[model samples]
Target: MPTTPVVSRRRVMAALFTGVACMNIAMAGASTAGVLIATESPGPGWSGVPSAAGVLGTAAGALGSARLVVSHGRRRSLLITYGLGSFGALLAAAGAVTGLFPVLLVGLLVLGLGNGGAQLSRYAAADLYPDERKGQALSAIVWAGTVGALAGPPLIAPAARTADLLGLPGLAGPLLVAALVTAAAAVVSAALPRSIPDAHPRTPETSGSEGFAVAFAQRAVRGPLLAMVAAQVAMVAMMTMSAPQLHQHGHGLDVVGWILTAHMIGMFALAPLSGRIADRWGGRVTIFAGIGTLAVASAAAVAAPTSHTAGIPLSLFLLGYGWNLVFVGGSSLLSTQHRKLQGTVDAVVWSTSALAGLAAGPLFALGGYVLVAVVAGVAALIPLVALTDH
Candidate 1:
């Protein structure tokens, strides 16, 4: 049976803070690639390593989550996530200091595994609320992370400079700060109420692998999953390429930081209320609106990279906001569809999104910004069309 609706604002705040810490650490790993590629010529083909690390981490985490979903359950899995992530952050920092690419790869892989697990933690947040308000709870968790994402780069900036002063690579300093963030997340995770154990209540009709199979085969699950998969690819591709896109157009890293912050603001600022829209309007309506927003954002980005005058920031902001809507809506739908089999559905969602992102990076590199934006826009249109037709 579903739990009571006891998610007070205070509890929501606490949970959001916990999630934010974990997300901050997870996202900080991504900046490592940019830092590495910029600071050191890692030779040709190595430019993609950091992004690969993130993907690999996500994959590992997803797989681990799958195993835990069947075995120890969600809460225990998250505990392992924070614990391993803390160690991975430390190891990555050490590898950066020593300039050991191999070690860095290993460390990042561990971090990625942790990331996969942390991603599922958002679902745990949703479970804290009642079915009617699950989307709102999920959005609150995402919104909490928005602050960390905005501040993430600056957090490591000073450390990077200090590392440079101390005759160490700047990546070293950022890794250290990331470690602290991970540790903090671990402490927060410790505070989560353990009242509800990992697995949802099982029944003859909705238990085990058979239940998962049935859910996936259903038409309702398919629509949301398809929409979610496409939206994830576009959002990840745009965000991944933003730095390069900005750089090519004569904007510095600082500008990229500001743009990212604006994007975060766009997503987080509206999150509190966006989920409520899902509650009132249904996920399908919100999903279409979200995709439309992304389509506009993508078109704007493709048409004008040099035009940073309000338009660029506004476009990116819309893009971010659109992503939040799609994610929240898609997730809400999944929760509704799977109900008892949420953990399994979440695994599929994360895996699909990660695979899409993994594919997006190389596509962006080969096709460049214009082509990538077009691809993302086209992809966004698929969901829009589907939703409109329905």
Candidate 2:
């Protein structure tokens, strides 16, 4: 008798991690390009517009992808989202060539949708592993992002040279790279298994509202949800403004890239350790550690001089590190609870994060980096209100 062949979980996870790494490359490249383009444009407070639009798209995309995951599956949803990202990157490239700010904004919005979908990859990783290793699985996938994140900023110069050689606008070069990478991600996503192990299988009769109610009713879920939201708000608000703020203080692109690279390292380099901490000590304890780290980081940011020096990079790194702990720990907590409602729970988390990103621009404009840092510090403290011994 012929035996059925089984796909290895390790292979599936490896493919997923590769896709996520590619997606992060595209995202980081777009971010660097957006900052340069927006800064060079003649306008007051326009630097944040692209990021805001992208974040709004991310919010919408998260909800949309969640619904698609519920209806179709992870593979299809990821493919569609990556396709949208490719289209968005093309638009962004064209906009850069034409020097059209509005078009660039629109393109970034579309790209954000893809980003939202990519964020789901972490959750998918959790589904593939046993409960005890959930944190490790999720963090391993997230750690894959380090490759792209660290590489993207450095590629800005090379991409610009490539654009010049191709007779395209220098700023548009990264977007072109983004388009190619995102398309590759889509192809890779197509190879994902039809069904993930331990994934929640709901009937067509199940509704998003039903999932949401189930998640909200549980205290275990609610606390982690709040921690995730707070972490996102604090992280996004500070990180988005860091580049522009440094640029305004007369830092060059290379310097900015280096600082951002350091930040990205902090974000992904310690994922394995963070995951182990979460698994061994519990998510709540990890969250508390993250909050304390964020508090100190924010204080350092407020005190750091506006120079192209080690101070800013160190501060940013700390900030990123703190965010990583909260994100991985909180996500593990969520994954452990109400596994059946994963999609809806993720939607809520991403949507809240999107809103926070959207709000960051105006907040920065109002009170400068110090105000933003203060606000972020305050937000970081929110998880304390819902702390539990569990």
Candidate 3:
């Protein structure tokens, strides 16, 4: 009898991780540019454009990617999304050079779509492992973001220099760099072996919309989804406004960069430990702990004086750490809930999260930093009320 060929899980995981890291590099770079470009926009209240566009783009991307994953498989979905991201980056760069706000906004939205697709790579990592080890695998892929997060911001200056050499606007440099990195990621994604199994078998009857309907019908699934949404809303709302708030308080750009880096570290550096905690203690316990931490961090942000430099960074770090816990815990729980509807379930989580993020900018504009923090703290408590041990 002929034996079946054995696929190397390690090699496949390595490829996924590499692709994820490259995507992160593009994401981080684009994110930095998004903020700066938004700040430079001529229109009043345009600072939120990128954030809103990001949220909207993510919603669209999540739905589209989910459908593609259901029909075509993960590698093809990733390849297409990354290509979209590269094109978006180029558009953004062009917008920067020409000072076209609409073009820039559109680019940010498309770039965000790319991020949405990359976010699913974590689930893909988990798919390769057994249930008991899913948390670790997911967190390992998430931890890969640390490399890109650390490397991305520092490139701003270098990117500026490159832009000058190429006779482009300085602000356009990061977007151009984003385009290159994401394009490379597309190539890497295209190389992914088709033999790697999906997390769940696709069902022809369950289209993306039907999958959402089915997943949302379950109480167990709703709990995790709500947890993820609250975490994302709170984290993105606060983190998005942090730089401008600090800059308004007279902090330098370099300081903002360092603080953002610290936040990223909090988000990704300790993810493995968070995963282990979830596995050992149960996701419910871990989620409660995460919410508690987030509450404390938000309270700290509200209480700390604007001049207290150390306080803000510390609070941001705590916020990121809290987000990491909830994110990992909630994701693990979701993965276990309905294996067959993984793509749609993930899409719903991201789309809801994106809607919350879209609201964040306007919230900040209307209520200021304190209001954002207060609202985030309150939002974090909703999961506590909704989630129960199953």
Candidate 4:
């Protein structure tokens, strides 16, 4: 159920785009920094911990945001989520400064919450448009990540340099920048026009474990849910391992950064086109394309060594676009669902991705990147069987 807006749809949409871009920039910087920062700690392995924490936080945030929207509406939900994101960033910075992995992980978790909020902004965009235009609306918000993709990696060096000069951890700079920008993102949340409240606010009886059970019980919800989860699991598992894989192969942060940039571009740059495909050819076709590309990406990763010039980066790029397809396709499938389901769907997706993140390290350790890629390719296939004309 969407609330009627007092303001023009375009104004609200612009704010959503801007707010998403800001979150992406912060996330991009923090992701690299988090990896580098975590590596500094001495332990059995931090590979899965940081990404897992962030993703878990994302799952929590997604769930919380949906319930919040049901009662208070989208704008209020955005405000709360971004605010938590900002505080979480600062907490992460403190962790960096004190050389405490626990603190850093906690901060990352909170920051993930904010990111989770940003992720659902696409659904907020969905409320403004009709079903016919939902794909484009979702894509417009998703494409905003391209800004982060291009701008984020470049900031790593300069932000780290600033940190070094400030006598802080070299990697702390990006986290600090993340903190600042996420704060701004919270302010941007205010720009979203207020939503007309649902006729009846969701009571605890209708919104907790019972609520989720009811929503998940619907047969129509299951297909898109599986597709969403598959994309996230495959993408997150491969991605969580990519940086460490590169570092192990003697690639520097600069190379890792460049590769990530390519990956982000693939994830976001052509979102409009993907959205159009969903709109024109239908989400089933769009989802098929995503699943196919993910398989190819996995095979590509296996076909060549990490050092191969184009193999890893190009594979990652395809992987990103593949995730995009499923993401857009999945969301578009839900355009007709009760808006209450958006948050839960996103929560499930991120939650599985968190598990995927946790699993990547062990999988890599056992059979190396090949095994992880294989796992991802296999996950993509699960949804293919469930997808229908919808």
Best by TM-score: 4
Choose the strongest candidate by lDDT. 4
Decoy 4 TM-score against native: 0.92
Q: Which stretches of candidate 1 lie over 4 Å from their true place?
A: 1-13, 32-40, 43-48, 197-205, 209-213, 248-250, 308-312, 337-347, 350-367, 384-390
Better of 1 and 3 by lDDT: 3
Local accuracy of candidate 2 as per-residue lDDT tens digits, 1-390 = 221223656767877888788878887778768866886784425666676667666766676776777778878888999899899989988999999988998998898788778877888788766677889989998898798768877777688889999999887988998899889989988888776555443354643335566667677877877887787778777877888788778876677778888888888889999899999998888888888888887888888747457666877888888988988988888774433365555566656666665566677677777887888889988878787635
Q: Model 4 Cα displacement at 229 (Å)?
A: 0.6
Mind giving the per-residue lDDT tens digits that candidate 3 earns over 1-390? 222223656766777887778877776667667766776565214555576676667667766776677678888888888899889989988888998978987997898778778777888777777777788988998888887768776677678778989988887898899899889888888778775664444345643334556667677677777887888778877777776677567775567667777777888888899889878887777788889989988998888726336767787888888988988888888665433355555566656666555566677678777887888888888888778645
lDDT of 1 by residue, 1-390 (tens): 645444543553475457565555456534544434532456422444555565567666766665675576555676687678768777777777777777776776676666666666556666566677777877777677576656775555566777789888765776776777777776776666554432244432444435656666666776776777677767766666666656667775457667777776776668767789888887887788888889998988888855666766777788888887887787778664333355455555555555555555566567766676788788877855455444
lDDT of 4 by residue, 99-187 (tens): 88889889989999988888988877776676777899889999999998998877887888999999998888989998888888889
Q: How far off is residue 329 in model 4, in Å?
A: 0.4
2 versus 4: better lDDT goes to: 4
Off by over 4 Å in 2: 1-7, 42-44, 199-214, 337-341, 388-390
RMSD to the true structure for each prediction, in A, is 3.4, 3.2, 3.1, 3.1
